[model samples]
Target: MIQVVLLGSGNVATHLYQAFQKTSEVEVIQVFTRNQSLDFPSTIQVHSYNQLIPADVYIISVTDLAIAEVSKSIPFENQLVVHTSGTSALDVLDTKNRRGVFYPLQTFSKVKKVDFSEIPLCLETEFEEDYAIIEKMALSISKVVQSVSSDQRKALHVAAVFSCNFVNHLYQIGSEICEENNIPFSILFPLIKETAAKIETLTPIEAQTGPAIRRDEKTISKHLDFLQDKNQKEIYQLLTQSIQNVKKL
Candidate 1:
């Protein structure tokens, strides 16, 4: 079994711990957190860096800013240490130990249980030998594992923000508009699902619709006039122009 130590109490850490439990090939031997955590069993929870045990891999799944700090605190050297950050470079980890990245390309929420097999695991390592170890661990839980470089990971993270985070914010805005107009937000569920489903078979440019794509100025003006929120109006105008600009390409 591949012994593992997870060093964070956040969503990624929690979900990773759960996923590892279901696989017989990997075992999360211990978890190190800054505070006493309710997520993992207390028996394996260590709050001090000195209490960390020897493991095949140590995953620092903390905030990007704290990754270096946590890595430096580890009392050992020359062991494999990786971080679960999509945007952070592999060098962010302290050089005392072997450095690597095990970024899962998905938005994690504590409330939502994700299928580990479906999530893409982006792996990178400073040493070529370390890649096989990381890949073996990744393949234990996920089918989609790829060796992504730092530059490629950065670009992938930005694209994910645009596709997932920004789109979710627009859904919130749509929900608020529906609520204010006394319409059921659930009514948009089918449309939202269909919009997402279209991209599976059609490129976004080919699937594009709405007044902005058609250059219907009257409809665009009607939307801008209907929206009372200044921020919403600005966002609508900006997105409308952005759509037209893309169409010109």
Candidate 2:
């Protein structure tokens, strides 16, 4: 079994801990978190760095800003230490130990349980020899894995923000528009699902539709006029121009 020590108690850490529990190939020997109150068993949870025990791998699933501080706190050296960040470079970990990244390319939420096997695990290590250990640990919990460089991972993270975070914000705007028009937000579910499904077979550019794609100025103007929210009008105009610009490319 691959002995693992997980650090942090946030969504990523909690979900990783849960996923590791289900697999027989990996075991979480301990969890180090400053938070005194957590759902994890008290027996295996440590509040201080000094209490951290020996493990084959230590995974730091903290925020990007906190990653460096956490890595610096690890008392032991030369152990395989990995962080679960998509945007952060591998060098962010303290040089006192072997550094690596085990970034899962998915948004995590404590309330919504995710299927671990479906999430893509992006692995990177400063030392080639440490790669195999993280890869093994990743494979134990996920069916999809990729060896991603820090640069490639950084680019992927930006694309994800555009694809996921920005798209979700657009959905929120759509929901508000629907609510204002006395339309049920649930009515848009099928459209939303179909838009997502199309991208599987068609490129986003190919899947594009609407007045913006058609360059229908009249319809675009109508939308801008109908939107009372200044922010919504700005967003609509910006996206319309973006779509048209992409077409020109």
Candidate 3:
């Protein structure tokens, strides 16, 4: 069995711990966290950062800013250490230990139950030998495993922010507009799902439709005029212009 000591008690850390618990080939030796009230299996031992125990692998699932600080605090040397970050480079970990990244390319929420097997695991290692160990752990929980370099991972992270984070923000804006008109946001759910489903078989450009793509000046102007909030109006104009620009290419 692969032994692991997981650091942090946030969404990623908690999800990893729960996923690892269900895998027969992995054992979480201990979990280190600053939040004493964080919930976990009663069978598992939880400790603070200063009381970290020895394990075959130490997984740092802390915030991006805290990654370096947390990894540097680990007293061990030359041991396999990995962080769950998308944008941060693998070298952010102290050179005292073997460094790597175990980035799961999916949004995680504490209240949401995630299907580990469906999440894509992006792996990177400073040393070649460490890759297999991390890959094995990844495969134990997930079916989709990929080897991503630091540079490539950074690029992927930027794309993800645009695709996932930005798109979600747009959804929030849509909901806000719907609420303002006494329209149930649920009315748009089917269109939203259908639009997303179309991308499964068609490129985003091919899937593109509506007034923005068609460059219907009248419709675009109507939308801008309807939006009272300056921020919303600005976003709508910017995105509409972006769509027109893409079509021009």
* C-alpha lDDT of all candidate models, in order: 0.95, 0.93, 0.91
TM-score of 3: 0.96
> Which 10 consecutive positions of candidate 3 have the poorest summed lDDT?
37-46
Give a tens-digit lDDT track for model 1, residues 13-43: 9999999998988999999988998889999
Residue-level lDDT of model 2, residues 1-249, one tens digit each, is 999999999999999999999999899999988876465888899989999989999999989999999999999989999999999999999999999999999998898999999999999998888898888888999999999999999999999999999999999999999999999999999999999999999999999999998999999999899999999999999999999999742
Candidate 1 error regions (>4 Å): none
Global CA lDDT computed for model 2: 0.93
Preferred candidate (lDDT higher): 2 or 3: 2
Model 3 over residues 39-123: C-alpha lDDT tens digits? 5754454665667778889999989999999899997888999999999999999999999999999999999999999999999
Models ranked on lDDT? 1, 2, 3
Off by over 4 Å in 2: none
Q: After superposition, how far is residue 143 of candidate 3 from its true place, in Å?
A: 0.8
Best by TM-score: 1
Model 1 gets an lDDT of 0.95
Q: Candidate 1 has what TM-score? A: 0.98
| Candidate 3: Cα lDDT at 132 | 93
